[model samples]
Target: MVAAALAICLRQRGLNVGVMKPVETGVGERGSTLSDAEYLRAAGGAVDPVDAIGPYRLAAPLAPLAAARQAGTVIEMDRILTAYERLAAGHTLMVVEGIGGGLVPIGHHFNVRDLIARLGLPTVVVGRATLGGVNHALLTVEALRQRRIAILGIVLNHTAIPSGPSGKGPDAIATRQGDSTVELVKELSGVPVLGPLRHEPMLAQAWEAGLGKVAAEDAIRTLADLIMQDVP
Candidate 1:
């Protein structure tokens, strides 16, 4: 979702934005609801075909490698790179979202990190702002750093505010926990940390409105500025 919003922001800034998912899981057959790739395409207002945007759309909502295996298929890196280059050719910048975390498997032996290294794109780590986020966020940053990938920044997203033992309310202890994760991550992560993007469920139902709101955010704007600096 953050990636989609970033695409929207880039386009709003007057850049010819291109979006790609490389591999998308749980994408239903033709006539089904909008998949992540479709949402991203809409975000950028791109006219590219869905095949070029995603390249691989697996039916099962599993990891790319697992879903491809279930469908009796294989994920070829060359195919993905071909699609990426095709889209990149006509756009100012390509926003390629990872299938999952950096370690997500694509082929039998390849992972998302390998794909990123191959694409040679700087990445913005989007972490969930909740308890245990520190570990997940830091580990991801470390993984990218180990591979010598340029770290753009981190965006901590608050997916939801769950109820604590005190019961459901804004003052729930879990809310505080979620809020604290952002601070904890910032204190520890040496790389620039961008957002604690508030939970916005509307994005699933209203693409433009939801993304428009996110695009107008100061954080998203700042992140966009950073991305522009990194990309040629």
Candidate 2:
């Protein structure tokens, strides 16, 4: 969902965006079901074939190295990097969403964080905005920092919003959520909060069109603005 949303957001800004599942595993005879290459192509209306999106489509749906091992194939790092560089060439920004958590295995000895550290791209760790999320968010942030990856920001994906009446209407609700996120950002490494993504149909459309919803637009733009502010 965050990948979809980011694709939409970037597309709306008129930036060329490519979606890659990169190291996919667990296919029967077809292919990886969670593949985002097609979705991104369709969303971006790009003529580039999905193959150009750099999918390592594996057949076991396990960790890349494990799946490759199970299938008697090698997980080639050079190949993966080549694919990523190919798509990243013409775009100002490419949002590469990982398969699982920050620690998912990528190879014989490396994990997902290792992949991000190698790529050296600014990364936004997506986390659920629910109970226990703080710990998960902070720990993941720490791990990524330890790996030396530049932390772009934290994106709190709200799976479900509490149902209630707010006297402040949408603006109020947004303000309250924004304040909470700002507090979290200040407390955690001073990384900006990219805002919460509420599950909604408009969000799907905005994502497809690459347009940021009101909240996402403000938050993403603010992060961009502030992150640039820190640039010397």
Candidate 3:
């Protein structure tokens, strides 16, 4: 969702942006199977084919390698690179979304970290803004830093609304936890916290509607601009 929203925001600024999700898993049986790639295409107004946007679409909802093995295929890194080069050449910028987490396996000898290193693109780590978020974010930052991957920043996305008394909305505890997660991630990772998007069910609804730039919220646009600021 963050990837799609960011792509839309970048396009709104009149930049010729493209989107890619090199490997996708957990595909559904009906309707827009390659959901993430589709969303990105809509948001960025990309004209690339689905194969270019997502070179590998696995049926199983598992890690890339496992999914590929289950489907009796192997992930071809060269193909992904070729597709990416094509998209990069056609656009001023390309938003490439990574699957799962940094350590996820894309092939037998390669992982998401290796792929990022190969592409030489800075990363924006998206994580949940909730209890225990700080630990997860810091671990991800450390892993990326270990590989010397340039990290653009961190985005703490609120995936769910915190329920309060009478279940009205986020309670004080949830708010404090979210705030602390953002601060600690920044202080520990030495990476800027670009956004702590407040929980909004409407964003999901918008994504379901069309996943276009028109569905992106103002906060998403601000986050997108911040990402561009860090780009060379």
Give the winner by lDDT: 1
Instruction: Estimate, for each residue in 68-147, the C-alpha lDDT of model 2 and write its tens digit.
Output: 78888776667777878887776656667687778888777777787777777778788765555667788888888787
Clashes of each: 0, 7, 0
Candidate 3 regions off by >4 Å?
A: 29-34, 208-219, 230-232
Q: Residue pairs in steric clash, candidate 2?
A: 8-210, 12-210, 25-61, 26-59, 26-60, 26-61, 27-59
- Candidate 2's C-alpha runs over 4 A off are 26-34, 161-186, 201-217, 220-232
Model 3 TM-score on a 0 to 1 scale: 0.89
Lowest summed-lDDT stretch of 10 residues in model 2? 206-215
Which 10-residue window in model 1 sums to the lowest lDDT?
162-171
Q: List the residue pairs that clash in candidate 3.
A: none
Per-residue lDDT of 42-94 in model 3, one digit per residue for the tens?
77899998878988987888889999999999897888899999999999899
Sorted on TM-score, best first, the list reads 1, 3, 2
Q: After superposition, how far is residue 32 of candidate 3 from its true place, in Å?
A: 5.3
- When 1 and 3 are scored with TM-score, the better candidate is 1
Clashes of 1: 0
Per-residue CA lDDT of model 1 for 79-185, tens digit only, reads 99999999999998999989789999999989999999999999989988888899999999999999999998999887767655666566466677877888888
